[model samples]
Target: MSQSFSLRTKSFLAGLVLPLLLGACESSVSVRGNFPDPEEVSSLEKGVHTRRDVADRLGSPSTLSTFQDQVWYYIGEKVEKTAFYDPVVLDRTVLIVKFSSDGMLEESHAYALEDGRVIDPVTRETPTEGQDLTIIQQLLGNLGKFNPGGNK
Candidate 1:
């Protein structure tokens, strides 16, 4: 009702609302993102180099597959957040380098998220007969409980 009281209330509301609007604007302006180029990876010529040479050129790969020991893989993913809350996957890159039996670079390739997944995600559950069995249980199961010809 009083003019002074109304002015104080308006000042308080202004202080509160201004910061909120500023924060919203700041958040809207703030952003995070990344990009990777496949061309950053060097090429491997058939006769130019060996594994060591390739390593010397492109550092060590991120991973190696057990089934294909000769193959080396590099995979990376990036997640970006806006205003420190909304998370998004900005980009991803996969580089694969295959080696020959002699440990030389056999083949090399680079991939992007837009390229899509090479392997499809299988949702069908596999009937797993594999169960956790203790070593004692395994041994006892192997031994007959009541062997008629037992040399007990």
Candidate 2:
């Protein structure tokens, strides 16, 4: 084979091997998150089960309502991704289970990121005191408005 033909063959083989090599080099991901099912939470009957039983079946409640001792909140968040390259949270499922004071299941709600866009806790519009600056003032903000040329 000609040198050019051999080079082309090697290039083509390398192209095929590139993805496989990268894929092999990737770190193995252990799915570190688990989210409970809303329906499974609903199956739990608060009136029927005691605290011990509740804990045994549903694992542990995430938070207990401060004001309401009876209200037990079981919150779970799970984020799944396709690849480690970007590490995107491709799928997010949240299950919030509320149990009554008597140890009965009161409410079971689930939320999926697929249902809506991610919400930012912080607001983009920040409140500033005093008057708003104009284009020139805002542009030359640090320079200040005092100019010797403008003096009478």
Candidate 3:
């Protein structure tokens, strides 16, 4: 009876432990945006492919140029994350397709992850020219400043 009980206990612990181990080892992959195929992009001929033809082959672009409607951009990113870590970018691709005023393709450009630049965000707060008042001062300062007529 004890032998059977011990074997059952081992089996139960193994079931729980195995799943936890597998779960811990699992990684997640996340893909965002439209990544155009190299072969299809290469097939396009500048000055030959029209807007309609490009759309049919590559689908809608991820975004259009901010100031001009002549350029279309396709941006793609792939990120991977382990069980508890922040996601890491595995791949990034940016494809830019420009069209002439007549709607024919003018130029095509591809940018890989290595071609990108990283800029650190500014964190320091700019000090404004003003008096720093305490809570009591702020409350007292507003006591006589109310204009019931809504004018200065």
What C-alpha lDDT, on a 0 to 100 scale, does residue 100 get in candidate 2? Answer: 70
User: Distance from true position, residue 21, model 1, in Å?
Assistant: 8.5
Per-candidate alpha-carbon RMSD to the true structure: 10.2, 7.5, 4.2
Clashes of 2: 3
Q: After superposition, how far is residue 59 of candidate 1 from its true place, in Å?
A: 2.0
lDDT of every predicted structure (CA atoms): 0.70, 0.64, 0.94
| Candidate whose lDDT is highest | 3
Cα displacement (Å) at residue 120, model 2: 5.2
lDDT computed for candidate 2: 0.64
Q: For residues 1-152, could you state the per-residue lDDT of candidate 3 as single tens digits? A: 99999999999999999999998879989999999989999999998999999999999999998998799999999999998878899999999999999999999999999999999999999999989999999999999788878965
Instruction: Give candidate 2 regions above 4 Å deviation.
Output: 1-21, 24-33, 37-39, 66-69, 77-86, 114-117, 120-152
Q: In candidate 1, what residue range of length 10 has the lowest lDDT sum? A: 27-36
Find the candidate with the highest TM-score and give its number: 3
User: 76, model 1: CA deviation in Å?
Assistant: 1.7
Which sequence of candidate numbers ranks them by lDDT, best first? 3, 1, 2
Instruction: Write model 2 residue lDDT over 80-106, tens digit each, in one string.
Output: 344445454545665555667566666
Against the true structure, candidate 2 reaches a TM-score of 0.47
TM-score of each: 0.52, 0.47, 0.78
